[model samples]
Target: MQEKNFITVDGKRFHYMWLRDNCLCPECRDPNSFQKIYDISEAQSPPKPVSVVEEDDKLTITWQEQPIHQSVFPISWLMAHVNELDTPVQSSRKIILWNKTDLQKERTVRHDFHNCDFDVWVNQLFSLGFTILENIKSTQELESFICSMGPIYETYYGRFIAFIIAMRYTLFFPSSLFPLPSSLFPAPKSLLRSPCSEVPKNQRFVPHGYKTCYIPVKPIKGTEAVDLAYSAVGHPLSPHTDFTYLNLGRLLQFIYCEENNASGGESIVVDGYRVARDFRQNHP
Candidate 1:
């Protein structure tokens, strides 16, 4: 046994103890057992104190026992299990900004039945509040690029998705610097007339000829899935129940990508059921 250094999540320093005598994995405990408790004691032989290192939102503990021992856990875990520790401390940067409006928008957009590419649509709204890019070039090059898109990533409707012109630029830029030009993406006069000017001009852009549709889990390699495109940004998307409006039921996520001269934007998706299952379990 060795003296161990424990750093409370709130930055306080002290010794630590776990109120458990034996480490029990699920296999070691009865599956139906309601709960288990263990006793704690001071180390039999006090050696050098352990060191705690904080890195990238995680805390690592290292101690010099007869055999060196180390473990790492998220800083949030200490805050969550504060009561189990002898002393509780608060973290300096535990505060998170929950954009309620953004959450509401997420719920609404995911459920919207309209035929608009979800990523393009969300990016447009985020950019200008709302936009309508019109008179797009619909160039042969753009068409060729769309053709190059393989069926691996196509939407449920099997249409390739992208902006009208060939050039790739920022859609989320300030209105003052509209990325895509109207010469290539001209807005419809009717749609422009009704648009909320509150939206930044730069935010609006027309989608290529591709129509919006549901994004399936199946990889349409070389094809782009719009919804999966933006959701890949690593945000916590809420759990959605069945859809009442359309028999389409519920979707897991969406995916999309832009080709030609771009790198490092590969798609990633996590299983919702696995996330839910892990959230409900406590381990040894």
Candidate 2:
């Protein structure tokens, strides 16, 4: 049977342990296996008061570390180390806060953005996380954008609500741990070729002559989707990420069809990376 104990520090029972040995710091854990030690030390204690809350079977801990450190821990992990603790241990959680002023400025930019100012919008995307290019001349322009760089590839995961090829351009972006967040939109269906009998009747679409196309990362098991082209009529596309494979430094590329008979659907891009970085710079 599993046993549990409370850790007392500074005359307060924290119901947990604190030791360099018991610390779950990433450096102390095995990268391959992701397991750590449970040793608690006597010299360890937080300089400031830390708060703990117990709800049902889960434990929520709050510390001086603001946004990042505040998290819920499983009661089981707490019980495993509480028995041998003597003092408060340093938590690796770093608190982060969103900058309200910058956020407001960004909102103003979004509200003030005009379709005529494509260059300004592009620069904004470079400063932000992603960019949108409206008034695309034709499907050829969309194709050209996706095919601008070498060694690019499109993917088909069959998960799209409306069947369209999703191009996955992995080459563009820096390999930074801290980078700008970004996202993109699919092209129009007029650019792809038909997906013959190899695709299901309901799932089949005309492929848009995209070479080196592959499958997108699985949003669901046993399913596949790719970037072809999106329809222009009332395609209310919200902001979205492509895959978890992406790192921090990434640029979002979006092209919207601006032809006649187009109902409604303005392109919208965001700069989540800039938002985070600005927040960190201003707050930190």
Candidate 3:
């Protein structure tokens, strides 16, 4: 057995363990069942490849051991796992930064849900950090649309939470002044008088275990005397990405606007990656 756990096959290097695990022979893998018959731990030492040959995309390897004397691999399968084998494949699509002129030229970025293809939608999202999707009639339709792409990534905030000031009036009272009921302390529905008895089941936006908090952007009539933080006074929120510490980072943040009567709540987006690139180029 060779100490080096790699072998060059058809000009591509593959791990010995990876090659051994993917053995397609009838002894290693059941012909009818297709399940692996050989246990990975059964190999006492690294199985070394003594001979390797390629014919018409098929790769054959002769090992220097018994019970798993030979193995065959397809070139296509080997190429597909090139990244896993520590080979980097360059991507064709480059990230493009947009200016005001670029935004004007690409004004028709909004895709209609009824008419858009999945690949087109995904491509647009990949190219641009965010995209506008119009004509999504209801919440159910939006949920269904997202579910089609993949599972909804529930975070510390849970699946979804809509911030409506009126619904969370009870939360404004200090816990010292008005101690919260044990049932109403943690859950979003605790703020409600009757836990969504009035709203229809389907229309209920906040799912169970979802956390909710409401901050008034505009000052209420009586609360004008109390000085508040800049955020409470409708100041521009500092641009930031959410949940970067978590695995994969927050996948996406969806904002649904029901109404926009108040001022100074406009959305701002900046490509952090593009900014870093520009900074490095200029500074260096």
Q: Which structure among the candidates has the greatest lDDT? A: 3
Off by over 4 Å in 3: 1-92, 166-234
Tell me the lDDT of candidate 2: 0.36
Scored against the true structure, residue 239 in model 3 reaches a CA lDDT of 53
**Residue range with the least summed lDDT across 10 consecutive positions in model 2:** 169-178
Give the alpha carbon lDDT tens digit for every residue of 52-127 in model 3. 7778888888988864488888888788777343354365655457655665786466888789876766766667
lDDT of 1 by residue, 158-218 (tens): 3323321111331221000011111112222222233322323223333323332222233
lDDT of 1 at 63: 49
lDDT (10s digit) by residue, model 2, range 1-284 = 11133433333344333322334544434333334422222224432225656677665545443333443556666665444534753544422232445545563334222243655554554454443344566545544544443223333322111233212211110000111221233334343334432322122233233332433432211112122113221113344344455433343333233232223334444555555476458644
Clashing pairs for predicted structure model 3, backbone only: none
How well does candidate 1 score on lDDT at residue 270? 30
Q: Show model 2 residue runs off by greater than 4 Å.
A: 1-125, 153-241, 247-252, 255-268, 277-284
